[model samples]
Target: MTTNTQNLSGQSILAGAATTGNGRAVHGYNPATNEPLEPAYSLIDLDQLKIATAAAAEAFESFRSLEPAKHADFLDAIAENIEAVGAELAARAMAETGLPEARLTGERGRTTGQLRLFAKVIRQGDQHGVRVDPALPDRAPLPRVDIRQRKIAVGPVAVFGASNFPLAFSTAGGDTASALAAGCPVIFKAHNAHPGTSEIVGRAISKAVADFGLHPGVFSLVYGPGATIGQALVADPVIKAVGFTGSRSGGTALMATAAARPEPIPVYAEMSSINPVIFFAGALSEDPAAQAKAYLGSVSGSSGQLCTAPGLVFVPTGAGGDAFAQAISSQAPNTAGQTMLTEGIYNSWIQGVEALGGQPGVELLGRGTEGAGQNAPAPAIYSSSVEQLLENPVLQDEIFGAASLVIRYDSAAELVTALSKLEGQLTATLQLTDADHETAAAVLPTLETKVGRILVNGWPTGVEVGHAMVHGGPFPATSDPQTTSVGTLAIERFLRPVAYQNFPNALLPRPIAKDNPWNLTRRIDGTLTTTGE
Candidate 1:
């Protein structure tokens, strides 16, 4: 439970075994100081990587059929092991990613809480998705044969760690938790920016696997070049599905590799999104200065490295809008930037901001003071017209930092037209009151198709992890809009339905068997029924 740099192997944990690779070694760097941390991690070759995938395939047979109690227990144990790491985990993550200790501590709790949530989901057994259609021996035209169905694990899954969230969206994050809950073996590709943090959490999961007496292949943590090993992992025939959280370019590249395989597989990749916020006249009439502060806080928080950060704001051109803009101009100059995840990310953010600022109609609204750190850059907000935003594609691209664009619109019709031109987004917000209901209703349909989640009178920076919450959207927001990367529904991404026709009770899966051994809720003849119902 007590982990430190001295005990860190900086090696790939393959099938519960510590492995050292001969390929190039990489070190985790402290972004706040721009210095490398101790214990360089060795990169694994493609052949070495195969060992993990092959073991995962071998483990799937037994793992996919685990008893509900044991399966739920395994997930619960993982949560406990991660929680036991405690302060050590937070300290290591802070050193690697330049995130504050308080933030990392809360993220670690969120990570464990989600694992435990999945444990509850496993015990309930509803995810089995069982259904039965009784045979009809006598019918006017013909007899109907017996048919039954239930969802099953797809197979081994490849998960890529995220850069922004070292704990909540990395190692044992939502993607890995949901895949494991669906009974799929996982081969996790650690993010190079936070190798040490990955190692600490990877060991926790490995310990849980050992404690449960499950196949060591149930989980494996790997390190390597993203271009070489990352794409190769998706291309591996043994891997049946993939879970990714990163850039649009990275997600599209993996989608291509997955499609090219002899047996194509699904890649549930969370990619780019510039979450937009719209301000109606009435909502801005009440204390525009306070509203502006709240808006800027969401934009600049976590250095705007969040996937759900509000990158675009729509304000009407009038007195209320003028008041809001004046408040932003007054407060934005004082906002400070925090250290970013990596040097490459910092450099890319700078380039994006410069390119956006150079656009034909874009003008700098305000700039904040730079924070005291190696990679910290000043936060910036730009302004543009609806006409320019609709005409120029560059104005819509996500800067991926503490930068946002404020677009001025002349009328409701113009606002809707400008919104229609936007790409798919993870979220959209409306600042409205009773007077704005008509305007809000007019735009609801378009927003339904454009975003996964809609917020009213609130910013989109915080995402709730629960059964009903969706962290995905159409097209560019994620590779598969039907699936979410967070919440219980995410388990479906790694599962597929299989039908059994005219099969004897003895040969049927437990969930759909005649005896009803698993005690699952099932749909029979289009009616929801449980045991004794």
Candidate 2:
């Protein structure tokens, strides 16, 4: 099959327009066909980094002072612009990342949905988090001074895009959406795998900025080597915080860079996770076929590229467990080999499978149908005892592909011991029945300590973008578990609170002003209300 890669003018979008960056040239390739796409993108080196970040810093002055409703309009405009270019964005993303058209299309929707969600968040005024205290000048011993507090944008943000979920995690993705919603300008570093898609989305965001008559520096997208370009961005004094979604090593490196800066900055990175699924006795003993189908579907979706994929499953030992294992082995082989996002990911997955198969007390149960592509690999299932998993620490690392391990446990104590050994995860699932409530209750506390989102009798493949969704977890799952990268709260990562003491009403922030210009919800004299006493 012949396909035409877009003749994208590979250039960095610096402060709202395309520029041939002053750095070495980098080119993107079509992973499906192993063909290099047209036009070479100029890597943003140390010099271009200064220009982009400086623009963001300059823009933050005005951007942060804009009214909350104006910020909402800017965010809504970005969403509209993204929808305008949705078809082209999906097409470019599929050609570069080897993802199917439908998946890319849905991701485009998710990206725009996140933008609109944040727009609503800004308009609601909760993010401002205002509190005010009236002065008690008539006090006998000492007169109390008036005090006010509110949240404000940290400053310019540097966002590193992810290889998977190009539209939802790259360019104008969650990180950019949240930072912009917080009133911080963005200095985005596009992933090398999909520069064309980045360019297209970057252009759309730039157009939105102009349409709203905002500063051109409100958004910028650059591309280059991870070590150089990424490091430079994080180290820039103008960049107050960072947002990243990538491998553990990659995320850690950016974290180190931010820490080494003269004034250390926060790096909100979504790194690695081996989301585990535990099947209680009742769940394992009943409806084997349906459970098997759901398990396979979660593990094989997007070739298991999702961070929330069920990488490990625990089941009880004996006849019921054997039936579950048999069902898994039978259903797994039916899923055909899928084209991975990159050649490196495919090779790493093969090594992971080989390591698991060669480990002590591990058995290869099934292998799916293979496809004819350089970056395509078949899904595989392996089995081992809970004791073996406890013995081998290497088994806990993520493989980044379509694969999973089924561990059989002899007793409830053994299941707890095995789960205790797991590293921090994005999610954990409990396949339960009404009869298993006692067991579920016992494990709920442990699951809370090890994972961010706990699922009940459902797969963790789809993450909804909303007010309450937490797409982050402790440590390896993310740099900070307190913040989410996909919800309204994500804006908090780029915001910091400040208190105003003894300031006159005219000098106070609008949200905290005496007259309540914005009519925001705030605490006044220990009472929550829009009107001050």
Candidate 3:
């Protein structure tokens, strides 16, 4: 445990084997010490891309035909393999990302939990969306023909590893789990910031594929700079869909690339969000100190690197509001600074703070404890007027660090106006009391239009992985608001409906056959049941 015992092949994985490509070289880094880790990773070459994607296309034919139980077993095997890595995985991730062992351990659990949840979802047999309409020869005019419909996999997908949550959002993460559950193979691109961590997780997935005796092409992990292999994977004709989590520019660029292809595909990219939190007068007056403490904690956690961090907080302007601001100013300085995940991110956070502080009418309330590490960033709190935020669109952009912008408003109407000026967000939280029902009701519509999830007297930092969770939003928050990047529902994004007309029972998919071999719930002649009759 003292030495880094994690296996670092530093090679891209293709068709279940560790490989070295003929592209640019990349190395992982220890953000805490600003030192590079061992085992360099080579980018997947154009020839390798063709090989990996072709294998994926070849594997799809059999993978899509595998029974739901087999798919569930495969997913479960993957989770078990990941858990087998244990502390080695946590240690490597902590060193690479500068995240605490506890944080990485929790993220590891979330990753495995998501895979297991998708296993249960596939076992339920409802993802197929079976519908059958029997022919009615007794009808007047021409006889109606029998028709059936069911969902099918959308072919292979390209998944880009995220920089923040190396384990939960990278190789073998939610996108990969959901895609594999929907019967599509995945080609993962390792993030440069955490290549060592990606390699370890990728090895687990490769081992699971071998253990389950599934096709080797069912999963592959590629490495390189984001611009090189990333574009090649998306443009590969074999890849039918994409899953990404990164900056707005990066997401939009990928979307544009996918759109320009001869056969365009869906790109579910979670880009950016300045998840806003609104504070009601009653909640603040009830316990200002408690509210202030909670706010500081949420914004400062993980160096404020989370996508759902409360970047913007709305408060009422008055003596009570002044007291709340003063309380935050007093506590923020005491919150210790933490090392960021990457040097580039730390630089960006510094520049962002400068921009906000230099803006007209924006006042810096306080700064947190500073650290000596080159990649460390101190927490900061700032206050501004509603008019200033409305006039400066830049204020709405996320800082991607431990900083929160407080906008004080004189009236509820002003709060609504400020809300209207904001863009789409991943979440919107409202701190309200039972007596503030009317005001809560008034702001609900604005919140609904602006965010994917609405919170009642809750913080937006921690996202639950379940059946009802939505880790996505409109436009800037994600490319497609209709879909989410978390939970069992994410499987639907990689599936498409297919219908059969007048096909023989033997020719139809088992789930949609008139004989009902699979015993799945289906709409038969407009009635929902397990039996076709």
Candidate 4:
């Protein structure tokens, strides 16, 4: 089959309907047939980076000052627009990523839902403004000044599109939606693998903006190749904060660039993880086979492209472990490798899995190659002692494809210790029973330290969008501990709190005093303040 590649190199791409990206268009191939899907080009590059970011910064000057209601409406419109183009977005995503239609549709639902959720959240925040701690006074001999807090928009935001969720986490996804809702303009750097999908989503966003009469500078989606474009974007004075989801080396590079900026900016880069799931003997003893059965779908779902997919499974070295191992082996090969997002991605997954298998003290427990051709090798599982994992950093890095490790421990105490060694992650699961619940309780305090969320017997691959949902975790899992990747809280990544002192009613934001902007919630004289206080 023949495919077309879009070329973005040496082209102008910002402030207009330009498909020309700064980098050359890489070919989009059909993994199944090993044929080209379509001609695709990357988004434009460095020169365009400035154009996009500058436009976004320009937009913030006005967008940041809009009434909170207006901001909420715009957010709502974005979700609505994404909803309108659901089919096109999902179809392109499947073609680019080689994922099944059902998965992409679910992701699209989640994506649009996230946008709407943020809209609701921001409107609610306005209805009952962000909370602020007020100073003590009246009852005291000495009076203190007022303390006020308002969510402020940081300047232009640079968002690096994700390779996996091209629509939900890319162009019009959580990063852009939340940032815009926060009243910050956005500069979205499209991920190379799915630039066509990015363009479609980007166009949807642009149309939404025009329909809403929003500032054009408020959103600029650019494409480019090479590290230089991203490096330059991070260094730009106009971009105050960043959001990213990709590999460790890639994330680290952007972060270092941000840190090196003359006016250093905040970068929220979510490095992928080998999300670990712990299964106590008691938990698995009753239904080790069942646990493995459920995990078959979770681990192999999307070929393990999800960061929250279980990568490391902890089990005792005995009959139970053997049963679980057999279960995994029985189920793995059945799910043949589907196509990954790109050839480059497929290759990387293959190499990384082999590299891990080849690591000292590590043994392949299952039969499969990492990734091959358009399809990935079947899910690969390796066994390593908890002690080895504790001593080796290699055991923790993410492979970004269909793979996992089974870590054996001598005792529950050692299991606890091994859990403690892991860095922040999106999730940690405990496969336990009523009896093991006691052990799980003890491990919670330690396990929670390493992950944003803790699950019991359920897979973390399908993130729910709700109030209690916390989709971000400690370092590497997410750059900021306070922000979540799913649900309403995700918008916080795009917002910064600003405080107002004893300013006249006109000068103060509604949350602080008599102005009562949205007439919701607030703090007054060290009390739970409500609107009209």
Best by lDDT: 1
Model 2 C-alpha lDDT per residue in residues 1-533, reported as the tens digit of each score = 00112456788878876788787887788887788886789887788777888888789989999887888988888788778777777777888888899898889889989988888878878789888878999987999999889999999999999999898998889999999988899988899888888888888888888877888888988887888888888888889999999999999999999888889999999999989999988987768778888888888889889989888989888777888888888887788777888777788889988888889898987778776676788888888888789989767878888989988888877788788888899999999889999978888888889888999989988999998888998889999888889888888998899999999887888888888888788888878898853
Clashing pairs in 1: none
Which of the predicted structures, 2 or 3, would earn the higher TM-score when compared with the native? Answer: 3
Q: Which stretches of candidate 1 lie over 4 Å from their true place?
A: 1-6
Worst ten in a row by lDDT for model 3: 1-10
Per-residue C-alpha lDDT of model 1 across residues 1-533, encoded as one tens digit per residue: 23344478989989889899779999999999989998899999999999999999999999999999999999888888888778788888999998998888888888998998998888888778888888888965999888998899999999999999999889999999999999999999999999989999999899888888889999999999989999999999999999999999999999999999999999999999999999999988889999899988999899999999999999999999999998999999889989999989999999999999999999998788888888899999999999999889998898898999999998889999998999999999999999999999998988999999999999999888899999999989999888889899999899999999999887888889877877778898788887521
Give the worst 10-residue stretch by lDDT in candidate 1.
1-10
Better of 1 and 4 by TM-score: 1
For model 1 the local lDDT of residue 506 reads 76
Work out the TM-score per prediction: 0.98, 0.96, 0.97, 0.91
Which candidate comes out best when scored by TM-score? Answer: 1
Q: How far is candidate 3 from the true structure (C-alpha RMSD, Å)?
A: 2.1
Count of residue pairs whose backbone atoms collide, per candidate: 0, 0, 0, 22
Provide the lowest-lDDT 10-residue window in model 4: 1-10
lDDT of each: 0.91, 0.86, 0.88, 0.74
Q: How close is candidate 3 to the true structure, as a TM-score?
A: 0.97
